[model samples]
Target: MASTTLRLPGLGWALLSLLLAALFSSCCLASASPVMNGPPTTWLSAPVPAEDTAQLRVFLPSPEARDQFLWRLAGAGVSADLTTLGFCSSRCVDLLVPEVDRQAVEAALPADAVLRTAERNLGGRLRAERDRLAGDAHRTDFSGVTRASDFFEDFRTYAQIEAFMDSLLAAYPEALSGFVSGRTFEGRPIRSMVLSVGGNSTVVDAGRRSIHLQAGQHAREWLSPPTLLYILSGFLEETSGSANLPLRDLLSQFDIYITPVVNVDGYLHTWKGDRLWRKNRRVNSGSNFLGVDLNRNWGPNSTWCTEGSSTFPGSDVYCGTEAFSEPETQAMSQLLDSLPNVALAIDYHTYGPMILYPLQHTYDPAEGDDAAHFDHLATVMADAIRAVHGQEYEPMPGSQLYPHSGGLIDYAYYTRRIPAFTVELRGDGFIVPPSNILESGEENYRGLIDILPLL
Candidate 1:
């Protein structure tokens, strides 16, 4: 064999190349941990050292106690992938915590306390950054609407949002068509809107191509419901005598149904008390226990309390005592199942800037290419969003994100066969600057337009 050797680049060029590579890698890593810029919607946990342990979990007295603990812990230096469990008391804290953090964190806690710990999941760093940003609440310039739209003023209370919805209906009697689907356990209305293209047809009776969109499914994902409301305003506001032209066109092709603030009670809680509250305000059976994670309340009976959920009613990912126990989730479930033609569905959340497709409630992969419908659509939509607003997002299967079972996206796809996606929006935090709200929504709004046309 002839002796041959490749020459190295010049010192300067080599250094430059290394620097660029490092910068790119840094950007990618940062992207992986989407930043939060508002208040948290759930409680924090105990503090831990970074890059020290592979996993960490804390023993929470109850789900609510866990929330408060996690919030405080996040404020401290510790973060971990959460696996909310029901039966963890002081004695069994070791069962959940990573072997490394178990002894240290447990020693720091009360002797008789239960345990909370991290699973072998990689969500800790991301959760910390997101939570940090979420805690940075501020005000920003209003840039959501092009023309002079007055909807952007003070942060709307639950009462204000309802008043706005009511006004829309009253102002455009014929234009408004929809249902107050059901009430939250706390008696809050789960309002849904219908922009009927063919005038007077029930959404459940809609055809196979009918489109479904929802926002504010996770009460603490603050960017979602407001963006939805803004989009609704755009649809109703007649610009140049063609106000809803684009939206009207969309409605003509498919029945447009939007539900903002599905978890009305939780949404209100975010506004009123804790900005990080994730569960619905449903009173648990005994004691002063309160709330259930409505998002995890949709598992089929057979798959309840699997992964991606907690059996504890107080955990943020808590699956309810039973599937569909929350009236809000139940109402949506009935409506989705009744509508044979729900070709597409979106359950919007924020603080990740990722588009998540189905198969959440189960680890079983799809049987065929049919499952690719959501995956492909999500990519297209995310790309479209980036192009319009210069925002970036990742599109991936729901399982890749957290691998939870009994999620809304899973039920929509596996059970109903509707191509659904759960969109995780991002910002500093849930109480994000009012100014950023419109811009964030605009980016997503454009993305929605891109995907809606294809559907």
Candidate 2:
């Protein structure tokens, strides 16, 4: 019999115990880290509601100050809930900044500053903002959709998106089948739908070519999801005797799946609190701030920060704590597992008009690899789409466009062996406006039509 003796001095045991405690605590921390240095700006003196410890309300002097301040805050780890912004020859913006940085933020501003953390009546200010928007100060309504767009179900909320989905399904019941993909960290329902002429009969019974298209992984990219929605609407429309006849014919050939919004909680936060909420709402401690970049949560290439992302959990480009840590991301991962035959997958994003293929998540070229076949297919699709719209969409590997890692499109192509691309929808490279919705939607519809025939 062999006997081994293990001994630990009192101090050694204490250190070991402490290390164990830390390991346990980190597990409880939210998955994902932000890139901000030090504590996030806090409003030390603002009177907050009992139920809301993290409420923020900024009242700036001139509308110009509001825009500048909001941009600065967003640039410096502070998120702004913008109420109004526009251009009347020039741009003006009205916003509310989080209370976390109230004192330091105020002290840095001009003494005659209009920016304020507290006013005589907080509730009344909210009421006035609500009423102003209710009257359509910025002309928020969409032409094709009749419903009034507002904060609760704002122009880009999950509810409005789902309503639009319902409309698409109604128009093509035989071709559409809806599924609850999963739920957000905040428990909002993440929904998805499939569009196909043969429907489940084709996809389930025999082998069928499939394409998965998803958009709005980043909440602030409002233009991303709309293009997908428009494309779905066009594909399923019964254009019995119109120019869309070819598009109608393509829908019959391939099964198309769509996810309008991946980060529902963050999108809702954008409508209710901040217009630039770009991550999923995952709570963390030691600080009242939290969220993760859903686009950076794919499992294949974890820890690929420092290229186009950050490790400090407070930064806008924060990659999650670990790959697939997000339920929404995991849901998409599962869907891919179930639909392994997907010939092509697209994760749409925005503010940059381009069609990019793998490897965004890695610098390794897809030039001579087996993925070369899919890469060639992507070139064909990109060229065909651009020809129809006359919109110059550069077709290149992600590394060529921008160096990034752990992105969905990269994972789909490199790991799952499926051809995938990430389409950065129209925004003229960031100057998005509500009026451009229909035009952008139509362009995306045309692009999708051109690609569908090739697929």
> Which predicted model would earn the best lDDT?
1
Cα lDDT tens digits for candidate 1, 45-102:
1112123433443454543444334333333322232222222221122222333434
Q: What is the C-alpha local distance difference test score of each model?
A: 0.57, 0.55
TM-score of each: 0.67, 0.65
- Model 2 residue 326 CA deviation (Å) reads 0.7
lDDT of 2 by residue, 310-386 (tens): 44454445566677878889988788767746777888887546677777755677646645765666666566656
Total backbone collisions for each predicted model: 59, 18
In model 2, which range of ten residues has the least summed lDDT?
38-47
lDDT of 2: 0.55
Error of 1 at 30 (Å): 32
